[model samples]
Target: MAVSFLNRERTIATPGYSRWLIPPAALCVHLCIGQAYAFSVFNLPMTKLIGISRSAPGDWKLTELGWIFSLAIFFLGVSAAVFGRWVEEGGPRRAMFTAALCWAGGFLVSAVGVYLHNLWIIYLGYGVLGGVGLGIGYISPVSTLIRWFPDRPGMATGMAIMGFGGGAFIASPLSVWLMGRFATPNHVGVAETFIVMGLVYLCFMMVGAAIVRVPPPGWAPAGYSTPVQPKPLVTTQNVFVYDALKTPQFWLIWWILCLNVTAGIGVLGQASAMSQEMFRGRITAVAASGLVGLFSLFNMLGRFLWSSTSDHIGRKNTYFVFFALGTFLYALVPYSGAIGSIGLFVLCYAIIFSMYGGGFATVPAYLRDMFGTRYVGAIHGLLLTAWSMAGIFGPVLVNYIREYNVTHGVAAAQAYNVTMFVMAGLLVIGFICNVFVGSVHERFHMRAVEAEDEVEAAPVFGGR
Candidate 1:
C-alpha cells in the first residue's frame, strides 16, 4: 500500500499477510510475455501477407520469416545487457514499467509496419525496440526476488523466467483464435493481432509491475531458507565485480551455459520442421506443430520441477543431471528412427526440451549460491548474453551442417546424425565445467552492507 516512486532503499513494513502475494504477481507477467517463443504461429501468416503484397508472391520463403523471429531473439540478449544496470538501480517496479511500455509500443509499431507494408519497420519495431524490453523485463525482478526467497532461489527464478518459456503456450492458441476472427487470405490479420496482443500484454505486465517489490532488508522466507544450509561465499564484500570477473569460475560457467543452451536450442528451433521432415506420413504438419507445442509444455514444466528439485539437491547436481542426461538424449534424435516410431520420437524430444527449459530456470540460483546476490541482476544479465550467442550458434550449426550433409549425398536420415553427435560433445564439455565449479570462497564475491533498499530488508524479515 505504501508503494511510490520514492527511493525504495528506505525501511518499510508490510503485514506478514502480504508476503504470499509476490510470487503469484511474478508468475502473471512471465506467463504472458513468455509467448515470444510462440511467434512461430505467425510465420505462415506473415509470409502469406508478404507474398501477397510483393509483386512476386511465389518468391517469398519461410526462411525469410524465420529470420525475422531470429532477429528478435538476437536483440533480446543484446538489449538485456545494455539495460541490466538500469534495472538494478531503478528497482523491479520501475524496470517492468519500462518493459511494458516498450513491448506494447513495439506491437503498435509493428502493427503500423504491417498496415503500411514495411517489413523493415516491423523488424525495427519488434526486433530492435521490443527486444530490448524483453531483455530488461526478463532480468528486472531476478535479484530482488531471489533475495526475498533465499530459501528457494531456484524456485523463485524458475517462477520468473518460466514466463519466457511458456510465453508461446498461451500465445499460440490466442493467435490462432484471433487469426480466425480477423484474418483474410490476401492480407494477414497481423495488424489487428499485434494491436490486440500488445494491448493485452501491456495491461497484464503493468499489473505485474505494480505489484512487484523487493523483499524488505534482512528478510527471510516464512519458514526455513537457503541461508540456513551454509555455503562459503567465493569473494568478499571488498571484492569488485571486475575482480570476480577475472576468476575462471565466471568464464567456466559461461562456456558451460553456452554449450548447454546451444545443444538444446539448435534442436528446439528446428523441432516442428524436423519432425515434419523426418516423419512425413506418421505425423501431419499439424501434428508436427503440436509436437512443437508439446515442447513448450515440457519446457515450462521442467523450469518449475527441476528448479524446485535443486532446492533440495543443490544446483551442481541438477546441472550434472541436465548435461549428462541431455547428452545421451540429444545424441539419440537422428538415430532414433531405426524403430520408426513417431511417438517414441515425440517422447524423446519432449525429454530433451524439458532439460533445455530446466537449464535456463536453474542457472540464476546457481549464480547466487556461489556469487552472492548484491549485483546478481547485472551479472545474470551479462551471463544471459550467452543466450544471444546461442541464438546464433544453435540455428547456424544445425542449418550449416545439415546443408553440407545434403550436398555430400548423405541421405535425409543420416544428414542430422553427425550434428547430433557434435551437440553431445558440447554437453560433455558443459558437464565438465559444472563439475569444476570449486567453491567461490568468501574472498572472491562482491558485497554490499546496504543500499537504500536495505532500510527495508532487515526490519521486514527480522522477526516472523
Candidate 2:
C-alpha cells in the first residue's frame, strides 16, 4: 500500500491544490542531479588516488577518467529514451523515487570502487546506474509542469530546468570543500566524499519525489481559455509518441538541439582550461575557476530568462537568436584572446553560456508546440539522444583538435582559434535546421475518436 502511493492515480492533484508548488518539487530532483556538471571537480583528485599527490604508474589516466562523464551522459539519453513511456504512464512520483535510489546507490558503489582502485566499478556505478537516475529525474516533471501551466509552459519548464543549470553553482564548491575536509596524508578522501554527497543527494531528491503531483485531467487555470485560433506552429492535436519520430519536424528539431548543445557543451567542459591557456599568465587557475562559476551563474539565469522570453517571441524565433547570435559569439571568442582583452573574453562567453542554457530550457515547450502535450514528455526523452550524441561529439572535437594543434607547435593561445570557427560553423548548420522546422502534418495527429476513447478508458484518479 505504501508503494501504491507513488501510482499515477494517487498523484492526481486534489481540487484547489496550488499548481505553483510543482516547480519547487521539480527543482529538488534537478538540483541534485545537476551535480553532474560539477563532476569535473573530482577528476584530478580521483587521478591522485593511487599516488596521493600525483598519478602513480598504474593510476587511471585523465583520458581514461574522462569516460566517466561521457558514459553517464550517454546512458542518460539511452535510459530516458528506453524508460520515457514508463515515466509517462507510472507518473512522476515513481520515476523520481527510482531515480533517487539509482543516483544515491551509484555514489555508494562508486565510493567502493574508489577504495578498491577499480575503474570498471566506478564506470558501472556512476556511469551506468547514476546516468539512469539522471535520465529519469531529468524528464519526470517536464510534462507535469507543462500541463499545470499550459498557459505559460515555457516559463513553467524554465523554472524547473534552471535548477539543472544552477546545480553546479552549489555542487562545485560543496564537492571541493568536502574533499578538503576529508583529505588526509595517506588518503585523498574521495571515497568518503562520495558517500556523503550520495547520502545528501538521496535525501534531497526523495523530498522532491514526495512533493510532486500531477494536475487532474481537464484542469486549467482560472480565467484561462483555449485560444479562439491556434497560433502558428502551436498544435492542439496529439501525436502518438512513436508517430512523432516519423515527422521531418522531429529530426530537424533533433539536429537543432544536437548542434546547439555540441557548440556549448564543448566550451563548457573546457572552460577553466581554455581560459587559463588562452590568457596564459593573465588568468591564474583560481581566476579561471571563478570564471567557470560565473559561467554557471549565467547558465542558470539564461534558462529562466531566455526560456521565459520564448513565451512571447515564440520558440522558433528564440532558437533563431540562439544560433545567429551564438555563431557570432563563438567566432568572437578567439578574437578576444588574440586582442588580450579579458573583459571581452569573459563577456562573450557569459552571453554564449546563457544561450546554451536557454537552448535546453526552451526545447520542451518547443516539443509541445510541434507534437502536442499528450506525449510530449516521451518525445522529449527520445530527442535527448541528440544530447548524448553531442556529449561525445563536442568534447572529442574540442579536445582532439586542441591536442593535435599543440602537438604541431601551435601556441596554446592560438590553438583554440580553429575550434572556435568550427563551432561557429556548426551553429550555422543549426540555424539552417531551425529554418526547416515547421508544424507537424495532420496525418500524424491522433484521431478525435481515439482521443475520446483514451480519456474514457483512462483510470479515474482519487476515486473520482
Candidate 3:
C-alpha cells in the first residue's frame, strides 16, 4: 500500500508524503471546530451590554455585526488568493501553519477589544486577522486532496468543505452554552468567550494543519491512473488561472455562485430575526428560538447530506437541482402561508437551504475538472470573491428592500415579499447558467498537462 504512493526508484524526486487521510483530518477541524458563524449568539448579549452602556438598538445594531462577517468574507478571499500562491510556492504544511497562527491570534486580539469595550478592536481582530486564517485554512487541503484522489475530486473536496459549513451546527450550541455560563445582563462575558473559543480553535485548527502533507508526483490513486470514466475533453495540463478565467464556463460558474450565495446568506443572516418577525403576533420568543435552532439543524445537515449526494449524481446535475429547485422554493416562500400552509414555507426554505449549501461543496471538484488541479486552490480562492460580493448584496438587498416596503405602508407580513420575489428572479438566471455548463472544450486544454503526460509515457532511461 505504501509502495503505491511512493517513488520506489526515487527517480522523479518529488517528496513522498501521505495524502489520503489528510483531507478528512483537515475537514474534521474545519467542520467540528469552525463554529465562528454561530458567533451571532454572542451578538445579542454584546448588544445588550452596549445597550446598557447607552448605545441605541439601531446604533449598536446587529447589522453592524453583519459588517464584521462581511469584512471577514472579503478578506477570506483576499487572504486565500494571496496565500494560495504561497501554498503553491511552499506546500500545505507551510500554508496551514500560517493559517493556525492567524486563527488563534485573531481571537486573542478580539478578546482584548471586547474586554476594553472597543468595537473597532474586535472588528480588527476577528475580521482582518481571523478572516486571513479562514482563507488559508480553507484552501489548505483542497489541492492536496485533489492530487491524492484524482479519481474522486467531488467526494474528496466535498467531505472537507462540507465540514466547514456544518462546523457551526455543533459550535453554535456549544457557544450558546458557554455564553450562558459567562454572561451577565450588562456584560455577556463575551470577552471570556472570545478568549476561550480562540484558544480552543487555535489548538484544533493547528492540529489539522500540522497533520496535512502532499502526495508523491506522477502517482495516481490505487485503482485510478487512467480514469474509468472517459476523461473530460479537459485535463489539468498546462492550464493556468488566466486561461481558465478566459473561458465562458468560468463566468457562468461565477454567476451561479454569486446567485447561490446571495439567496442563502440573505436568509441566514436574518433567520432568527425573520422568525421573530413572522411570529410576532402568534408565537412566543421560546418558540421563535426553537424555529431558529431547527433552521440551523437543516442548514448544517444540508452541507453534509446535499454535497454527499453530488458524489452519485455528478456536479452538473447537482447544480441543475440547486438552481431549478431553489428558484421554485424561493418563489414559494412568500405565498406559502397565504396559499394556506406554513409547512410549505418551511419545506421551501429547507430545500433552498440545501441547494445553497450544495453549491459550495460542489465547486472545487467542478473547477478541478474544468481547469487542472495544479492551481485549484488558487482558482478556488479567486472564485470566492463571488461569495464576498454576494455577502454584501444579499443582506443589503434584504434589509434595504424590506425597509422600503415598511416605510411605504407595506405591512410587516408583506415586508419581505418583494425581496423574496427578487431572490426568485436571481435563481432563475442562475438556473439558466447551470443548464449551459458542460465539460470544457479541448481547445482550452492546458499545454503543460500534455507535456507532463508525454514525459511520463516515454520509456525510462532504465526500467526493470
Candidate 4:
C-alpha cells in the first residue's frame, strides 16, 4: 500500500510547468545524501567515546569505524548499478521517496546501534542501508534534468551535483554544533545526535520529493530546437542502458573517471594530515581544517563553473584541461610542499579538487552526449561504479605508498613525494583514454522505429 503511494505517477507538468523548480528539488536530495563525505567528523568522537583519544575495552577501533564509511560507499555503487533501471522505470518520485526512507531510517537505526555500543549494527544501519539511499538519491533527478534542459545538459547537472560537494561544508559545522549541544562529560552524544539529524534530513528530503515533477512526454524548453546535424560527439540517437556498457566509449570514459577521481580524492582524503605533516610545525591543525574547507568550496565552485563552461568549449575539451592541467598540479604538489610554500601548496591542491568535482559534473553531460538521454541515468549509474572503486583505491593507494616510504627510512615530510608522482602518472593515463573518446558507432544507436515502439508501449495518462 505504501509502495503504491510512492510509485503512483503524479505527472505535475500541466500547461504551465516551470523548470526552475527542478534544481531546488535536486539540491534538497543531494545536500542530504552528500553528508556521507563528512563521515570523518564522527570518526574521532566514536573512537574516543569510551576513552579520550583512545579506545578502551569494548570500544571500536579507528580502523573498524572507518569500515562504516567504506561499506556505505561500496553499497552506494552497488545499489546504483542494481537499481538504475528501477529508478528509470519507477520514476524519480518513487526513487527519491525510497531514498529518503532508507537515508533517514538508516540514521535512526544507527542511533540505536550507538546506544547499544554495537559496531556491526552501526555498519549495517549507516553503511549498508544509508549507502543505498545515497545511490538512489544521487541519480534521482539527473535524467529528468537532462531531458528537460536538453539545450543545457551540462549546466543542469552541474547545479544539482555541485550541492553534493557543498553538503560536506554544511554538515561538518552543523554536526560539530549538534554534537556539542547533545554532549555531556560522560556521554559523547552520538546516539542522540544521529536521531536528530535523521529526523531533520527526513523532513528536508520529503520537501524535495513533494516538489519535484517530470516533464510531460515530448516536452522541450521554449525556443529550443534539436540541431539538424548534431555536432561532433553529440548524439541525437538514444542507446539502451545495457548496450551502452558494451561500447568502447563507455569503458574509456570509465577509465577517465576512475583515474581522475583516484588522483584528486587521494589527496582530499589526506589533505589535513598532509598539510600538517609536510609543513612541519608551520601548518597548525586549525589551519589544516581551514584547508579542507577551502577544498570543499573550490570543489563546489568547479562543478558549476566548469560544467557550464563545457557548453561553450565542448565536454571533451573540458576533460582535456582536467587531465592535462590536473596532471601538472598533482606532480607539482610534492615540490610545493618541499619548498615549504604553504600558499603554493594550497593553491595547487585547490585547483586539483575543483577539477575533481568538474569531472563528476561534466561526465553526466558527457554520457548524454555519447549515449543519448533515453537511458543516460542508468548508464551514469553504472559509470559511478568507478567512483565506488576509486573511493577505496585512492585512499588505500595513498596510505600504503606513504607507509611504504616511511618504512624505507624516508622522513614523514617527504613520504608522499612518490605517491604524488604516481597519481600524476595515473592522470596521464586518463589523458590518453580521453583522447580515444569519440562518437559511438552508428549501428549501436536506437532506431527511430524502436523509439516509436517504446512510446507506444507506455501507458497514456492525464496530467495531474
Residue runs of model 4 more than 4 Å from their true location after superposition: 1-5, 52-54, 456-464
Reference-based lDDT, each prediction = 0.75, 0.91, 0.72, 0.88
Lowest lDDT sum, 10 consecutive residues, model 4, at 455-464
Q: TM-scores for all candidates?
A: 0.90, 0.95, 0.86, 0.96
Off by over 4 Å in 2: 407-409, 456-464
- Model 4 reaches what TM-score against the true structure? 0.96
- Model 3 off-target regions past 4 Å? 1-20, 48-65, 182-187, 228-238, 276-283, 441-444, 449-464
* Candidate with better lDDT, 2 vs 3: 2
Model 2 sits at a Cα RMSD from the real structure of 2.4
- What TM value does model 3 have? 0.86
**Who is ahead in TM-score, 2 or 3?**
2
lDDT, candidate 4, 1-464, per-residue tens: 66555552563467787998999999999999989999889988998778744677878888999899999999899898888877766678788899999999889999999988899888999999999999999988899889878999999999999998888888888899999998887888888989998999999998888888878778889999898988999999988888898899999999999999998888888999999999989999999998888898999999999999998899999999998998898889899987889999989988999999999999999999999987788888999899999998999999999999999999999999999999999999999999999999988888888866644442332211
The predictions' CA RMSDs to the true structure, in order, are: 4.2, 2.4, 5.7, 2.5
Q: Enumerate clash totals for all models, in the order shown.
A: 27, 0, 5, 0
- TM-score-based ranking: 4, 2, 1, 3
Instruction: Report residue 406 deviation for candidate 2 (angstroms).
Output: 3.4
Candidate order (lDDT): 2, 4, 1, 3
Residues 299-393, candidate 2: write the lDDT tens digits.
99999999999999999999999999999999999989989999999999999999999999999999999998877888999999999999989
lDDT of 3 by residue, 1-464 (tens): 43222222322224455556676667755763356677667677666655654465533567776667667778887887676656543456566667777877888898898777778887899889988988887887787777777777777777787778777877787778787788766666777877888888777776765566566557775666665555543454545565677888888888989998998989877766665565456546787667666776676567666766766777777788887788777777777745646577677777777677778878887788777786677778878888888988999899998899999998787687788889888888888998887777767665665546534532232211
How far out, in Å, is residue 438 in model 3? 3.9
Give model 2's TM-score versus the native structure: 0.95
